[model samples]
Target: MPIYTVNDQSIHVWEEGASDKQVALLIHGWSSSWFAMSPLFPILSRYRCLAVDLPGYGQSPKGDDPVSIVAYTDLLADLLRQVTDQPAVLIGHSMGGMISLTMSLRHPELIERMVLICPTISGRLSMFINMFLGPLVVLERVPFADRVTSLIETRIWRITDRVMKPASYAERSAISSEAHERIKADVRRPGQGQIRAECYRAMRENDLRGQLQKISHPSLYLWGMEDNTVPLRDASSVVAELPDADLRIIPNAGHWPHFEALVTTQRYVRAFLSTPIKLLKAQF
Candidate 1:
């Protein structure tokens, strides 16, 4: 783990692979840290893989910065400008995917391509989460809410983790126990109540469906067939909006397809990255 100073904030990054190879910046979703993306490291070893623990999560302190897609995109743009001269590949999941899409639209010169996994493209999420979990986030505005939220947040996430896993035991076993623990650890981190509430609110309020068509970068979109967090129909709608993008829904996989179907996910990523950008664009 290496900590880099970006916009005067200490951003923790998990760097892997050879420096001489092409750069691949991996961004994890809400409530997750760089460790959540560890499963894809082996497949992306051909590139200089850099996974970031965004400001609010993991080792990075949220501080006073407002957590929004634009704020995150600015932080990453500045970080990349300081670190790499050439454009890098963006691999983003969920909220991170929205950030990547925004980056491509805002700073197209800094991005070569993108890989979005089960991205949240609209304000609409699963009815269950929106109905149940969304209210808890709103309670953060009330007195002593942080204290109250801290106690139940862990329980809620643990149940969510189990529910998000694949149905089959073999598919569930594909994701290491340690990986699941890592995600839980992020929830247990101090001051996460405010961050979680803010992030959830931000994600729910932000919608990028109309803006995605402006993104010209050749992109790959992966969705879990059984995803309940972001609907499969929404995923298809998002892919259809993009100018140069393709969608692959992994069967028997849920929201975390990269972990549940590692081999299949890797194969798709490898093939996508190996193809010429021109060829990919021509397909659309």
Candidate 2:
């Protein structure tokens, strides 16, 4: 319920646990708010955990135009400066990962470490396809573009509903029924649609493959083998590019592995964070 006014935007933020020694910032993916990373709450709370609804999503107020991922990086940096004095570990999922990567490149001092979950780096061929066919895909934002994409997303969600059923059992088991309901309720916020549209637009225009080399922070890249959204094949390419990076794949998990494999994901994350880099390097 806490809100911080940053750069004329009202960002809804929440914190769990009270710790001056460590802090972790949770950044959600496209179409998701702070709740998307709720699966990590229990484990992350052991440290100082800060989850924020990016501008135009959840309780955060909407902006005039959908801002670019770089813009988000700037916003997050400013927010960090304003809120906590502690350097924070940035945990970003999907688009949030993109923001985190940008942050590392632009504001490495703000982060102690990074955890990227199914992060998007390159502007894949799919994005090109969307670029050429996008105008025809949607009709709202741009003539014939928004409508087309809206229709495509609607159908994609329909298919996702079917394909996602297998993982539902795990997702349901990971969180209580009540918590699941809360997640669904949060997704239904009025700003969600606009936020989704703006995000899609920003993604279409932003490509950061050229900038990955600039990031020097130690990073953990987590992937879900079953993720149809961002294929697992991209993981190796990302790892190869990052200077200090490690990879982990979650089995029987989709894009939302934190939800489907919450316990396993949290365990690995904590273990990774606790392990001394020198010791880990010695073992290798």
Candidate 3:
């Protein structure tokens, strides 16, 4: 376990695999912890993996400030510097994908490669959501906001466990009941509603579309073809913007391909990492 302070909060890190190989930073999506990325660690043991709790999740402490996507990216950049001198490969899911994209745009030199799983680049959220909830972003400064958010999150967790998560796995039958149970457990971390809500509030707060051309690192866009949660169409457009990128749609996977189609996703991940940077090209 490694702990680092950013914005007055402690971020906990979990390390796995051999340190001799290149570094791979594993970032979990919203309402998750370093443990959420555990499914990929054993398969991708070729590279040293650094997984983070991202404040308010796992054992990490929530800072006095509300969490935003930009804040996450900035903190990650500093954490990257403190962890290793070598450029690292970024592997992010959902909101983690947003942070990784921002990191690549703001600190390109620090990235060697990237793998995004159902990242929300654009066209995911509707204007109605932003219009209704955007003002709540400023309310993060209010002490009572966290209390209200936690109450709302309780209802969300109930619905998510009984409905959302089961629907996320396209090949639900392919995975064990235990796996789905683990996912349900992962999303219900304590006192994390404010971090979760603020992250959603932070989406589209930054414009990263046009700047995708600036990312020269070999990138992989591994998305679920049936991902209704983030939509494959939006991800495809983002992939088109990348200078050197590949897109692989898992036919039988939905939002959480890493868990639903572990073997197939693992194969794609290993093959992508094995390829030389210069030979990296777009593929479906």
Candidate 4:
């Protein structure tokens, strides 16, 4: 619930564990808050864990306008600089991964290492859709368009909630009844909708294929084989571009692998961090 002013944006940040140890920043996906990363918090708490609710999500204030992924990356870099002097390990999921990758490529000095989960990168068809169809979709903000877009978003949210509910880990399941209700309450807080809209706008404009080669930090790419949101096919393309990247596929898991398989996800993440970069590369 605490807030910080980074790049003139009021960002919501939560910190746990000792500040003297290595830091890990966990960034959540689109339409998600820090709660999405709750599954790994207990284990990750041994080290410094910082989870952020990006601008326009959770308790953060809305930005002046919609953001680009690169802009979000800059915001994150600025946040890191303001929050801690130590280089932090960046763990990002979905759109969060895009921001992490952008940060790694643009401000490598701030990052010690990275763990990207089902990252969003370029897809030939998605590129065409965003470049062409996206504008048309945004047009829905107009007179009748707003209503239509709202309807569509509502339907999608319902479906996604159903899918995610079952995939939540046991620890989460114990509190499932109240967990989602809490998330909904947080989303309903003032300025959340606008923030989410801006993040979606940013994700649509982000295309990082050209900058992938600039990333020099050691990285781990984790994918859920059954992830329908960011398909496993994208993993090959991501690993191929980064010279120092390793991939791990979690079977029977969906888009939120850490939630679906919390124990496994935590175990791997800790193990990878403890080992040398060379050993991590051999883990895949």
Candidate 5:
């Protein structure tokens, strides 16, 4: 693990696999750190994988600027330049996916290709989703809300652990106990409430739908069939806007497809990243 500075921000970075291999930069979603992308690390042995804890999440401390998509894209752009000389493959999840899309539009040279997992496009969505996220955003403004939320979620997960356990070992590994604890700790971190609230607001205000047609890189969009957070229906329409992209739906999975269906996720990601560009585009 190493720390890289972007202006006043200090980004915590973890790298795995061989240096000689093609670079694969993993970007975690909102309220998540590097661990959110860790499950895919094992399958990326052929690549020089790099994951970062964005400011205001994980080990990285919040910078002076409020957490926003544009700020993140700028940080990542500078980070990629510092970490590698070549354009690396961008693997972004959720908010990270939004950042990747923005980067692809703004700094295409920094990204050789893209793999967006349940990415956010327009801030709009179904009423059901609004009901789900609205309260969380409001709760962030309350004092000690994080502790209460964590306690409740911890209990809920504990109660359902056995019933919710995946049948396969590979899927189980994706959401191991260690990963759960780390994610819980991230939720309870100081200033996290403000960060979360700010990010939610920023995402709601920012829209990238109009810009999708400008993205030139080959892109792979992975969406969970049952994702309530950013439903496939809300994002699937944008696939047509992308000049070169493919959408793969993961069955029986939620927002976290990598956790719910590790093997399937790996299959699509590996094939997309390894296949020849011309051949991949031909299939679409």
Candidate 6:
């Protein structure tokens, strides 16, 4: 693991695989670090794999400005420019999926294909349904609201720390305590709490369904049939909006099919990636 400094932000990155293989960038979800995508590293090691901890999570440093989907995607573009000159595949989970969606739509030339795992489409239900989440949308909209919301956000994170670990794994028999701890421990650290507050606020406020229509790349949507965090109805709706998207529901898996049903998810990813997407090479 190494830290890459770009645009006054320190981003912690994990890279593996050969330089000759296709460049694949991995993005994790909200309140999570790059470790969430660690399961895919080994399986996809045949390709050039790059996983990053966005500012405020894992070992990455946070920026002073309020985090938004655009900021994260801009940082992703910066990292890609530094690593690869060719168009690469973008793989994102949860909040990362939202960022990836905006990135591909905003800068279509930079990305050739995509893999979104149980991504958030429209936040209307996710935010309104949760009592605490509804408040966040208001807090994000009001001036100087972060000052008060920051305290509430920190406390909520502390309270939900333990809950997220188990909530991520729906199939109890397939749980890996080691993997769970490795993926979650750093996120619950003392100072890491408030950084994700802005990201969550932005996620709650944005409706991504309209933006999905702009994406023209081949995309693979892998949803855990048992995912409670992002509902199947929403996932199906997401599939409907994308121009070229394939849906694959993993049975007996939860929000984290990559972790709970590792082999099956890997097989699915490999098949999707191998489907010969017309790589959009850089124009010289």
TM-score of each: 0.90, 0.80, 0.85, 0.79, 0.83, 0.84
lDDT of 3 at 238: 71
Model 6 lDDT per residue over 93-157, tens place: 98888878888877787887888988877743342225544455445445476556555766756
Off by over 4 Å in 4: 123-194, 277-284
Over 1-284, each residue of candidate 4 has an lDDT whose tens digit, in order, gives: 56888767888887788768777999987667888777778777656888999777777766785567887888889888877887889999888888888888888889888988878875222332345434643554355655565557666456435544443222233234465676555534433444455555666577666667777777878887666666665776776776446778887666677866667788888877878757654543
Worst 10 residues of 5 by lDDT: 163-172
Clashing pairs in 6: none
Candidate 2 all-Cα RMSD: 4.6
1-284: candidate 3 lDDT, tens digit per residue:
86877656678889876667778999987667786678888767777888988867778877676567778888888888876788999999877887898898888878988998888786244343345433453354345976775668766566455555434667443656787677667666666556656666667565566667776667888888667567666675675775346788888788788877889888998888888866664432
lDDT value for model 4: 0.70
**Global lDDT of model 1:** 0.79
What is the model-wide C-alpha lDDT for candidate 5? Answer: 0.76
For model 3 the local lDDT of residue 240 reads 75
Candidate models: Cα lDDT each: 0.79, 0.70, 0.73, 0.70, 0.76, 0.75
Candidate 6 wrongly placed segments (more than 4 Å): 124-129, 132-158, 171-173, 279-284
| Candidate 5 runs further than 4 Å off | 139-182, 281-284
At residue 111, give the lDDT of candidate 4: 87
Worst 10 residues of 2 by lDDT: 163-172
Q: What is the lDDT of residue 133 in candidate 4?
A: 37
Give residue 17's lDDT in candidate 2 (0 to 100).
74
Give the Cα-based TM-score of candidate 5 against the true structure. 0.83
| Candidate 3: stretches off by over 4 Å | 6-8, 18-20, 126-156, 171-173, 281-284
Best by TM-score: 1
